[model samples]
Target: MTTKKILIVDDEAAIVAVLEELLTEEGYTIIKAYNGLEAISIFNKKQHIDLMIVDYCMPHLNGRRVIETMRQNPRYSTTPVIVITGSEKQFSNFPEDSTYQFLIEKPFNLERITETVHKLLG
Candidate 1:
């Protein structure tokens, strides 16, 4: 089977590197973006992203805006999005639609992250 493609959008390079290593080991192709604007640029250029994992607090555009823009595009409207946020209270503002899933609080366990990705991609 072909490997799945996943986009990691976070302002921190360390977080992106860690996630890249973890997901790469699990046989998924990883794309790294340091901010929401870069993420959107990559998405527009690549056009084959299967999933997106975004940090809620990022400079320029922010995760919510990124997902909202993606949802507006017919090509990405059905794509799965997983938001990683440092605040649980922020999740309350997320869309009620099933297309978006979330991981609350920062510093998530690698195993849980992998599991959530599997569940979403499955």
Candidate 2:
């Protein structure tokens, strides 16, 4: 099987670093972006991104906007996305029909995150 490419987006450097380390050990290629605009730019440049792990709050544009923009691209319309937010209530802001595959609250369990990734990508 081809290695899955996952984009890890978050304003917090620590979160990005930890996620990179974890997912890399799991054998997935990772692309990192510090904020939502950078995330969108990276998303445009990369092809076949198997998944995305995005923080809800971000600079330039929020995660919701980033995901909404990505959903416009037919190639990523159904791509699996994991939105990590500090508050579960933030999820309500997304449209009812949005395609975010998973919502992981802050202080998430690493094991659960890994399981979700495998379930979505597999």
The models' CA-based lDDT, in order, is: 0.83, 0.86
lDDT for each residue of candidate 2 in 16-85, tens digit (9 for 90 to 100): 9999999999999999989988877876875678899988888788888888988888888888899988
| Candidate 1 clash pair list | none
User: TM per model?
Assistant: 0.89, 0.91
Off by over 4 Å in 1: 91-99
Candidate 2 lDDT for residue 121: 87
